[model samples]
Target: MTPDAILALYEWVIGACFRCGDANLFVTPIDAVVTPRGERYPLAACGGCVLDMEEERRRFAERKGEKYHPGRLGRPPA
Candidate 1:
């Protein structure tokens, strides 16, 4: 199976966001991130959390004087 499909399956098993612990039928499956201790963990986010994350990134970009190009950050509408 493809990586995305695998991630989707993993999300299906968990059924909630690692960060916010919000459960949903569909969540954005994030790629695994490595921590300072060398542990890897995959994450998922509900729609609301995803939008909030994007907004935070945009604000950070503005503060850094970098252009925040909003493109394809979230799931496409059904």
Candidate 2:
């Protein structure tokens, strides 16, 4: 590939987070979002974003009278 194309690919990967678009944040592959028009897009999210999403899930579970078990999404030691 050309130098410009390579650089563009690098930049795209660096900003691959579907939610925050923060290159510095570590990411995990999450589920995809399906639009009403039947388009599906994959997602990856940072730790903070995952925590926020978990919190929302917890709230919804409580509202529905269900138990919420948190997952192990933290980064392990190198």
Candidate 3:
């Protein structure tokens, strides 16, 4: 992907921290997928945000009276 697109996604993830109400958190890159096309990207998450996400998910699930599952993260195969 282009640098601009990658940066926008990075900024998006950062902004999501606020949406999750875990704005104090940030991601730490641990690994990244290499698309079959050969583009690489980072896979990371902030502990605080993760916790917040989990809590939100829990609330949503309870509100709906069932567990919620967020699908895997990554781009489609090339």
Candidate 4:
């Protein structure tokens, strides 16, 4: 997916997760607004007790870290 598409999906996911009380399922702290190419999203965790699924979240976290983390993007880490 293009960055814009991914960002849009991420926002939708965040909204759905929040509405479903699954906010913890996300790894990055995402805003409804589109993040710049290098902005970092907050790290999120799973809302359920399933530990095995954390790997997926970790993957997202890694991607977010690489793309949005300080030094990777022009902005400093929050």
Best candidate (score: TM-score): 1
Candidate 1 achieves a global lDDT of 0.59
What are the clashing pairs of model 1?
A: none
Residue pairs with backbone atoms closer than 3 Å in model 3 (clashes): none
Candidate 3 lDDT for residue 36: 97
Q: What TM-score would each prediction reach against the true structure?
A: 0.57, 0.56, 0.36, 0.21
Instruction: Report the C-alpha lDDT of model 4 over 1-78, residue by residue, as the tens digit.
Output: 343333333222232232234542443332343368766544332233123233344466797785322111212346
Best by lDDT: 1
Residues forming the 10-long window of minimal summed lDDT in candidate 2: 6-15
The predicted structure with the larger lDDT, 1 or 4, is 1
Per-residue lDDT of candidate 1, residues 1-78 (tens digit) = 333433343333435776688775567675567899999887777655656666776798899998764423434522
The TM-score measured for candidate 3 stands at: 0.36
When summed lDDT is taken over every stretch of 10 residues in candidate 1, the lowest stretch is 3-12
After superposition, the stretches of candidate 4 with alpha carbons farther than 4 Å from their true spots are 1-21, 24-36, 47-50, 54-78
Q: Write the per-residue lDDT of candidate 3 for residues 17-36, one digit (tens) a residue.
A: 32334443465343476899
- Model 2 TM-score (2 dp): 0.56
lDDT string for model 2 (1-78, tens) is: 333332232212223566677775556666677999999887777655666766786798799998865553332322
Give the distance in Å from residue 38's predicted Cα in candidate 2 to where it truly belongs: 10
TM-score winner, 1 or 4: 1
Q: Which stretches in model 1 have alpha-carbon errors above 4 Å?
A: 1-14, 33-40, 71-78
